[model samples]
Target chain A: SQTIHQWPATLVQPVGSPLSLECTVEGTSNPNLYWYRQAAGRGLQLLFYSVGIGQISSEVPQNLSASRPQDRQFILSSKKLLLSDSGFYLCAWDRDRGSPLHFGNGTRLTVT
Target chain B: AQTVTQSQPEMSVQEAETVTLSCTYDTSESDYYLFWYKQPPSRQMILVIRQEAYKQQNATENRFSVNFQKAAKSFSLKISDSQLGDAAMYFCAYRSAGLNAGNNRKLIWGLGTSLAVNP
Candidate 1:
């Protein structure tokens, strides 16, 4: 079965600090990966999606960025974090285009 | 510009009763996909059900089902015999369909409906 793993279930970072959140997929190869953020009492907002290595499409413009350094490995990073960056971050994988996605437990990021 | 709307921000239902959460989308594409995702307190996005645009019949999974009206562009989820575990934030999503050189599965999420199952 396919599974998604995200590390550091919760994070607390200071403003202007660098950030890195990693997501890895097991039992799948070259799957579509996506990063999403959900604010408190709000819906999910798609941040970035990668179809293949070194290929990323950003949905919302912000201080955050995403990279697919390796197949099945996706990373969300930021050179300088903002207060607005604080939210719950979720990583999900899709087998192919127009397919349903499987998601990770998510990382709760608190930027103070 | 594709958009999804979930009118109800919060909803409550009695346990063992049925509740329907409404969702509507605005799109020019004839072929697309609709989905309902449940997010528990753990924050894991779980696919509750999905409906393909071309399919006339609704999609069902155990106690969860979707009433997909392609013409009205409305897709609603009906939970039968709702349980306490069913309480969560339900998000309605939409994805465009096309065999593109790029990706065809970028999901547009609605504001979400918070379902609270009361005892």
Candidate 2:
């Protein structure tokens, strides 16, 4: 069985501070990884997705960026955080194009 | 471009009763995938059911089932004997089956519908 792990279940940071959220999957290799954000009582917005290492496709232009350093390790980072950047961040992985996505326990970041 | 639409922002149903949440999508591609994901207050996305465009038979999982109308572009989720645990934000998503790289496997999501189960 495959499992996804996301760190810092809840985060509180001041504005203009740097941010790093990591996600990793075990028991799978060369899986598709994705990062998504959800506002309070709203739908999810796709942030970034990677099919392989060193390859990232961003869905929207924003203050955040994503990277795939290792085959199963994905990181979401920001040089400077904005008030609007605070939300529920989720990491997901899939085996293939037709497979269902498996999500990790999200990180709730609060930017003050 | 493909788009998923869930018109109802919120819906409530009595416990043990049945409820149906509607979803509609627009796509030019013939082969694709549709999914229903449930997000409870915890906010973890849980895949409830999936339907393939090429299949005519509707897909069912335990108490959850989907009414897939390919021609109508409608895929609705029906929950039988709804429970309080079923209360959550339900999202409809579409994925293209194209073999192209980059954006082929990305899921197009809807605004989602919040379901409330009343006892």
Candidate 3:
């Protein structure tokens, strides 16, 4: 069975701080990974996705960027965070082009 | 571009009753997938049910089932014998099967409906 590991389940960061949220998949090879953020009482917003190592696509333009340094590792990073960046961040993985996404437990990031 | 719509923002159902959550989508592609995801207080999205575009028969999972209308472009989730554990935010999502850049099987989601199961 595939599993996604997302770190720092709850984070409180000051404005202008650098942010690095990590996600990794186990039990799957070359899986598609995505980063989505959900604001309170709002729908999910896809921030970034990666099909393979070093191949990252930005779905929405924002203060965040994603990178796939390794086959199973997808990282969401920000040079300096903004208050608007506060939200529930989730990492997901899927494969074979059409499977429904399997999500991680998610990280609650609060930018103060 | 594909989009999903969940008409109801919130709905309430008493225990052991039935509740239906409506969803409709706009798309030009015929081959795709529709899904209903439940987000409990835990905040992790869990897949409740899925419907394929080609399958005419509705999909079911234990107590959960979908009313999939291809021509109407509608997909509704029905929860029978609703329980307190079913109280959560339900989201409808659409995923295109086409292999394209940006498509990457990205799911276009609807603003979820908050489902409240009353005792």
Assess every candidate by TM-score. 0.97, 0.98, 0.98
In the range A3-32, model 1's lDDT, one tens digit per residue, is 899987999999999999999999989899
Best by lDDT: 2
Q: What DockQ, on C-alphas, does every prediction get?
A: 0.80, 0.82, 0.75
DockQ-better candidate, 1 vs 3 = 1
Cα-based RMSD of candidate 2: 0.9
Q: For candidate 2, write residues A4-81 as lDDT tens digits.
A: 999879999999999999999999999999999999988888899998999999999998999999999999999999
| True-vs-predicted CA distance for residue B54, candidate 2, Å | 0.2
Descending-DockQ candidate ranking:
2, 1, 3
lDDT of 3 by residue, A1-112 (tens): 8899999899999999999999999998999999999999999998998889999989888888999999999999999999999999999998855678899999999999
**Standalone chain B TM-score for every prediction:** 0.96, 0.98, 0.97
**Model 1, residue A57: displacement in angstroms?**
1.6
Model 1: lDDT of residue B55: 93
